[model samples]
Target: MIHLLYLLALLLCVAPLIPGLLGVVLPAASWLPPLGLNSPSAVAWQQLLSWPGLGESIALSLFTGLGSTLLALLFTFFILRRYWDTPQWRRLENTLSPMLALPHVAFAIGFALLFAPTGWFFRLLAASGLNTDNAINVVQDPYGIGLLIVLAIKETPFLLLMSIGVLQQLQVKRLLAVSTSLGCTHHESWHKVILPLWLPKMRLPLLAVAAYGLSVVDIALFLGPQRPSTFAIQVWHWFNEPDLQLLPRAAAGALLLLAITLSVLLGLRGLEWLLVRGTRAWQLNGPTASTYCGLVSTSHAVNGRYNGAGSPQTLHPALITRLRGCATALRRRIPLFAPFVLIPLLVIPTLLVWSFAQRWRFPDLLPSRYSFRFWEQELEPLLTLTGHSMLLALGSGLIALVLTIGCLEYKQRYHRAIPYWILAIPLVTPQLSLLFGIQVATYWVPGQHFGLWVFWSHLFFVFPYLYLSLEGAWRSYDVRLDQCSRSLGKTAWQTWWQVKRPIVQPAILMGLAVGISVSLAQYLPTQMLGAGRISTITTEAVALASGQDRRVMAIYGLLQGLLPLLFFGLAVFINRRTSRYSSPYSSQGHGPSDTSSTHSGSHHANDTVRG
Candidate 1:
C-alpha cells in the first residue's frame, strides 16, 4: 500500500514534467501537426534571434534574476547573523507567515502604490513644497531595477525560512559556543564556520528564487521593464499573438527561456561549490590564526621591527583598532528590520486606504474624502473571483498535503526517498516553459477539462512547497517513539495516528497554509490552462493592473492579499486549540514530573518545526 501511494505521488508530481518538456520541444522544432507544419527546421530559432529588442529583453531577465538572488541572499545572511538565537528572532519568526502569505501580485500592486511616480513618497515630497516632477521612477523602470528590488524584497522571507531548517541541522547555538571558546566573536564565527555549511544546504532554495525571478510573469507585468520587457514576458506576448504561424516563435522563446533557467541554476550550483568546497582553506583557517597574524604584523610595523627587506608589515595597531570600531558602529546602526518587515507593514495599510479613497489626490497624507462606494461596486465580482480562488486553493492544498504525508511515510518505511532535484524541478524550472507544453498536452484530450487541468497544475506547484515545509518535521521526529509504540503491540497505522500525527500536527497545518497560499498565487497556470474562463483573484488583479482605475485595482489587490492570510490565521488558531489537549505524554499515563520532561523534550525536538 505504501509503495502504491508513493508511486501515485510520483505520477502526480514528477511525471508531468516529461510530457511538458516534450510538448515544448516538438513545437519549437516546428512539428505542429494541427497547423500542418511537420518539417523539423531551425526557422523558429532564427525568427527568435531576429526579433526586435531580443537582446535587451534577455539582458533584463538576467539582470533581474541574478541581481535579485544576490541581494536576497545577502539580506537573509545579515538578518540571521543579527537575530538568530536571540529573543528578537522569535518576534521576526512571528512575522514570516503573514509576509509569505502576501501573494507576489498583491505585493507588486502595493509596491506600486507606495513607489510609483504619483505614489505616497512623491506626494510627501510635493506636500513639503519640493518639486516632485523630476523624481526618478521606480515602478516599471526600463532598466528593470524596480523589478530587481521587488523580487529581492519578496524573496528574502523564503530564504530566511529555508535557513531555519539548515541552522537547526548545523546546531548553530552549539557551534557558536564552541567558536566563542576559541576567542571568535559572533560575527567572525558566522562567516568562518556557519556560512559554509549554510550555503550548500541553501542551494535548492536559492535556485528556486533565481528561477522565479527569471520567469515570473504576473509581477513582471506590474513592475518589470516595458520598452523591451523581460524575456519571459516577451515569450508570453508571443504566445498570445493571434497568428498561429507565430506559434513556433513562442515555443522557441520558451525553449530559450528554459535553457537560460537551467544555465543559471548550474552556474549558481557551481558558485556554491566554489565557495564551500574549493575554498576550504579559508574556512578551515581559524579566526584566531587570522587575527593573530594581523596583530603581529601590525605590532611589527608599529615598532619598526620589520625584517631585512625593510617593508612595512601592515597598518599600525591603533589604525586597525579604529577601523574595527568604525565597522562595528556602522553595523549596529543599520536598520535590519526595515526592508523585510517594515515595508510589508506599510503596504497593507496603503492598499486599504487606496481601496476606499473617494477624492484622494497627490500631496495628501490621508485621503481627503473616503467612502465605501468602490468596495460596494466591486463586492459581487470580488466575491465570485475570491470563491473560485479559494476553491482551487483548498482543493489543491488538501490533495498536496495528503500526497506529501504519503511520500514522507513511504520514505520512513522503505528508507528511500525521491531525489531532491526531481521534487525541485517544479520549483526551479521556468513556469512558462512548463505550462506552455502542458497546455498543449491538455489539448490532446477530447473535451474541455480546463478546471481539472488548472487544479492539477496548482497541485503540481503546491506539492513541492508542502513537501519541503513538512520535511523538517518528519526528519526531526523521534522514530524511537514509533518503535516504542510497536513494542507496546500497537499497529503501524495506530502508532502513526495516535503517536506521530499529534506531534507533527502543527507542521502539517502550517504546510497546508503554505500550500494554499502557493495555489492562490498561481497566475500562469490559471490563465493559460483555464483559457481565460477561470478568473481568480490573481488573474483579476493582474488584469486590473493595466487599467487606469486605481480604485478597482485596489479592491482586487486588497482581497488578493487577504485571502491567503485568512487561511494562515485559521491554521494558527487550530494548531493552538488542538495543541492544548494533544500532548504526547497524555497517552502514556505518565506522572506529572514525567510529563514535564516529555513536554520539554518534545519542545526541543520541534523548535525548528515552528516556522
Candidate 2:
C-alpha cells in the first residue's frame, strides 16, 4: 500500500518532466506536427547557432551565472566566518530569515531603482553637484556588473541561512578549540577545518543559486544587457514573439540553456570534489589559509595597494574614534542591504500605479490621473484567476510537503534519498528553456488538461525547496525520542503522528510556507503550461507590469508578492505556535533552548549545542 502511494506520488510529482522536456525538445528539433513541419530536421539548431553574438551571449550566461554564484559564496563565507561565534553572530542569523524571505523579482526591481542612471542615487548625485549628464549607466550595462551585484547581494542571505545548519552540524567549537591550540586563528580554523566540511554541505544550495542565475529571465530582462540578452531571456523573447512558428527556435534555445545549466552544475560538483574534498595538497603543502580567510585576498589586496592607505595607531584616541566610526558604518550599512528587501516595495507601488492610470506614459515619472476603473473592470475576471492561483499553490504545496516527508522517512529507513543533482534538476535551470521543450511535449500527450500539467510543473519545481527546508528539521529531530516512544509501545505511525510530527512542526510549517511561496511566484511554468487559458496572479502581474499604468501595476504587484508573503507569515506563525512554547508541547518547556529556530543538527542536541 505504501509502495503504491509512493509510486503515485512520484509519478504525480515527476511525470510532468516528460511533457515539459518533450514539449521543448520537439519544437527545438523543428519537429512539430501542429506547425505543419512534419519532418524532423536540424534547422532549429542551425538557426540557434547563426544568431549574432551567440558566443557572447553564452559567455554572458557563464560569466553572470558563475560570477554571481562564486561572489555570493565568497561574501556569505566572509560574513559567517567573521561573525560566527562572535557577539554579532546571533543578530546576523536573525537577519537572514527576513532577507531570504524577499523574492528575486522584488530584489532586482529595487536594485534598478538604487543603481540605474536615473536611479534614486543619481537624483542624490544631481543634488550633490556631481555631473548629472551621464548617471554612470550601470543599470543594463553590457558588462552585466549591475546584474551580477544584484544576484550576489540577493543570494547572500540564503547562503548564510544554509550555512547555519552545516556549521552547527560540523561542530564549530571543537574545530575552533583544536585550531586555536594548534596556533591557528579563528579565521584559519574556518578555512582549514570547517570549510572542507562546510563546502560540501553548501554544494546543494550553491548549485541552486548557480542554476537560478544561469536561467533567470525576469532578472536578466530587467537588469541584464538588452542588445543580446542572456540565453534565458532570448528564449523568452522567442516565446513571446507573435510568430507562433518561431516556437521551435525558442525551444532550441531553451534546450541549449538547459544544457548549459546541467554542464555548470556538473562542473561545480567536480570543482568541489577536486578543491575542497578531492585532495588535501593545498591544506598540507600550502601555507595556512587564515590570511586568505578574512577577506578574499583577490578583491582586497589589489584595492589596498592601489589606494595606498595608512595604518592607524591602535588604542590611541584617533584609533578608537576610527573604530567607533567603523562600527557606526557597519550599522548604517545594513540598510544598503535593503535593495534586495525594499525594491519589492517600490516595484509594488510601481505595479499598482501602472494598473490604474489610463494616460500615463513611460518617462512621464507619474500618471496624469488615476482611476479605479481597471480594478473595477478586471476584478470580476481576476476572481477566477485568484481562485486558480490559490488552488494551484495549495495543491502543489501539499504534494511537495508529502513528498518531502516521504523522502525523509525513506532516509530514516534506508539511510539514503535521491542525489542532489537529480533533486536540483528543476531548480538550477531556466524554466522557460526547459519548459519550452516540456510544453511542446505536453501537447503531444494524448489529452490536455492545462491546469493539471501546470500543477505538476509547480510540484516538480517546488520539490527541491521543500526537501531542502525539511532536511534540517528531519536531521535535528531527536530520534531517540522516537525510540523511546516505540519502546513505550507506540507504533511507527502513531509515534510519527503524535511525537515526531509535533516536534518538527515548525520545520513542516516552514517547508509548506516555502513551497507555497515558490508556487505562488511561479510565472513561467504557470503561463507556459496553461497556454494562455489559465492566468494566475503572477501571470497577471507580469502582463500588466509591461504596460504604462502605475497605480494598477503597483496594486497588483504588491498583491502578487503579498499573497505569498501572507502565506509565509502565516506559516511562520503556525511554526512558532506549534514548534515554540507555541504548541501544546510548549508545556514540555522546549521553548527557546530546546529549539533555537536557528540550528537543529545535533543528534545529541542537548550536549553538542551551545547556542
Q: Could you tell me which 10 consecutive residues in candidate 2 have the lowest summed lDDT?
A: 600-609
lDDT scores for all predictions? 0.83, 0.69
Off by over 4 Å in 2: 242-245, 277-279, 285-385, 410-420, 446-448, 475-494, 580-611
| Candidate 1 overall lDDT versus native | 0.83
RMSD of each: 5.9, 5.7
TM-score of 1: 0.89
Clash totals for all candidate models: 0, 31
Top candidate by TM-score: 1
Candidate 2 structure, TM-score to reference: 0.81
TM-scores, each model vs. reference: 0.89, 0.81
- Per-residue lDDT tens digits of candidate 1, residues 1-611? 77876888899888899889998999999988878888898899999999989999999999999999999999999999988977667767667757877888888999999998888888888889999888889898999998899999988987876676568769999999999898777888898889898998888779889999999899898789888999999999999999989998999999999999999988998989888888788777667666767777766655555567977655667887787788778765655856788887778898999999999877788889999998998889888888999999999999888888999899887889888778878888999999999987776788998899999999999988888777767877789999999999999999999998888877777778778888999999999999999999999999998765888888888889988888877876776677768765322312111111111001121342332
lDDT of 2 by residue, 88-183 (tens): 665554555545555666555545544556555565676677786854576788988887888888777777766665676688888789777876
